[model samples]
Target: MRDPAQDPDESGFGFPAPLWRAVARRRPLGLDVRWRSPLRGPWLTSVLGLVLLVVLPVVTVTGLLSYSAYGPQFDQAYPGDVGFLRLPDFDWPTDPPWLYRLNQGLHVGLGLVVIPVVLAKLWSVIPKLFQWPPARSLAQVLERISLLMLVGGLLFEIVTGVLNIQYDYVFGFSFYTAHYYGAWVFMAGFLVHVPLKLATMVRSLRGTSLREVMRTGRDQTRPETGPSHGLIPTDPDPPTLSRRGALGLVGGGSLLVLVLTAGQTVGGVSRYAAVLMPRGRQPAGTFPVNKTAEAAGISREAVESWRLTLTGGAVEVSLTREQLLALPQHTATLPIACVEGWSTTQTWTGVRLRDLARLAGVTEPSSARVESIQESGLFRAATLQGNQVDHADSMLALRVNGGDLPLDHGYPARIMVPAIPGVHCTKWVGTIDFEAG
Candidate 1:
């Protein structure tokens, strides 16, 4: 069924082999069936894939867990499209106060660490990307589709994640929604690729450990000859670097990137070294502020006359900050972890959430919504599951680090829920509407 022209060049470019070679010799990238990179082979690609197996799962799991910490069941679920997958509807644990901090730190840090490996893996498989005839059969067609998804989805995720952490919004869409959906897309492709390539990866690495491959010197380095994934070039150029040098270059670059940026995740003196992290080199106060009172448009007049309104009670009760302070005050040390990956732990003094619920005549409340005084913004309101509302450490915070909350630190009143995302803590809280079952 193959046409004579299709059999000649097989690139679907319609040019015969001689003409194709003539045209390709003058181009930046050619349709030549083989590449000339001596350091690239199945051995290299498998090495990078193995590294990703260890790193990518941590990033993916923690990233999904970060979203779960927002209490998606209580109207805080972002992206709202609950597609083919939805995280379990359960109360995010509150026992470990530093839960979100550790989870997000690993997510953001490991995410950065995987970049070099991905790049190296892509480089090793460049010849396959330009494979002639595109697909020879249905299986090849399916592999090509999955490969496209794997590469494209991951590239999109990396771009969005990097720009988001830097507070750059050039993407012109909601970072939260787009990144959330994009993660699912990448994961779909990633899942398909792993099973399909697991056997090939294992075969390529059998008896050929990375250390053995890396020990090869420039003089001994030769183009791979085996038909391992069809990546071995037919006409390889002379070696520019040994296999050892290539692996070292990629490994060294990845290690360097991890060391420079991971300091922010651990915090303290190490954080000072993570100058590349925007939040790591933040304010010298108790901790950095996500949004200043000025930015949230908080007015001094409103602060002076601030009243926390408790609704869904026997009687709607409004209390001034001083009056609320008169009630039994409790203190809890909790970490406010942001989705952007920076976290700070501070001791907060405030009225217990259960007490507030009682005041609202909703003892043993099913759920509650905390509304901010900001008037408008995605973060202005957040709904909390009953467990979050009733947690012993959950409070409407009035002070931090034994001092009155600063204007930039959600002064006057803020909700501090154990193990909650920072944004969902609902800074400058003006109202708490309780729901009784």
Candidate 2:
């Protein structure tokens, strides 16, 4: 039997308040006891980690936009007939189909990185809750409310994020859409959380080094004094750094494992690749085509005499569509992601964007512009700045999923940009001018 007088938390994992108090004051066990950055070094690293969090959605959005905006392959693989009821206007692909497997993999991999980095930063600061200093009463209440909001929002995001990763559905909705929408919520909470954290960091860094204070042991008995001391309350006796360092190392390592392994386990690289083109099958044609092109009001002849222009700030001259195709045709199998949140893997045969840049008298492929003809009848342009077009993974795609140009997709030629949004992968064969920008 446990002593009822001694245990309060009752979990028996650690000593209770009475025991700690006895240790602190050399008083009886019936009593209670307690103890506890210049925010710069640790806080700087913490903020960098936060910045990485912001980049997560940016990366996902870029990749999705690259594939979805155009492609006959995308239409055939995930038909629009299965559009979501809630977002009826948009096509939603949530089945664990091959393309979805890989798309979800990237989504979950990026998310796994978010969990640990956030938790480590949180752990470093939670102890200071007790060390919280006296503020204006109203200010303190508001600060407390803000913290609660941050915590609540973080919990909601993390829970939903983890569940989605595990292929678990919470509400009666598709995890993909829910996860994307939840990301905005998480981002809102994150934006709110940053200012509060900045305030905390300012308070933390306003003082002398925490190491110096702890070394002098001056913080063990009294309230901190001077701007060097700032707002952290002095504990009667605080815990040591040795344990904290070990715990931080453990937490950081766990996060790293999650980050590196995610691309393999969750992203579905092998399966997506296999399904989009399949194995041991001769490809059917050079471009993605089907009946969908007619339905979309696109014509079959639009592909003939297709030209890709290359001109930009980096180059003194531009090349026309004929000059580009005459250069050399390079090909590879790459994945495409749509803004509507679906993806497909296909074999793309084309002249490498780099090769075309070189033939166009471009000594530097870094500064280039590729334009896409959108369904809205407006051209969408993206700069291949600073070795972007020259990148080995970026190409002018003429074939998809082991087949010829299907009319709905850019028939004679298209662009394929790997590891970015699908929007960057323009469908129609057009002029890509190489110039410095």
Per-residue lDDT of model 1, residues 1-437, tens digit only? 22222254444433244554555455545565557787777777887888887788788889888878876666576877565466776778876878888898888877877888889988898887776555554445666787777888888888999898888999899987888888887888899888777766777788376677767789898876554566777778899898888888988988887777777667767777777888667686568778888888997777888899999888999999999889999998888888877787789999999999998899889889889999778788998888888899999999998999987888799999988788988888999999995
* Model 2, residue 283: C-alpha shift (Å): 16
What is the Cα-based lDDT of residue 11 in candidate 2? 27
What lDDT tens digits, residue by residue, belong to model 2 across residues 119-176?
Answer: 6556545543443222223344455566665556566656765564334575667544
Model 2 ranges with Cα > 4 A deviation: 1-140, 147-297, 312-326, 338-342, 375-379
- Residue 276 in candidate 2, Cα distance off native in Å: 18
The stretch of ten residues in a row with the least summed lDDT in candidate 2 is: 274-283
TM-score of each: 0.89, 0.41
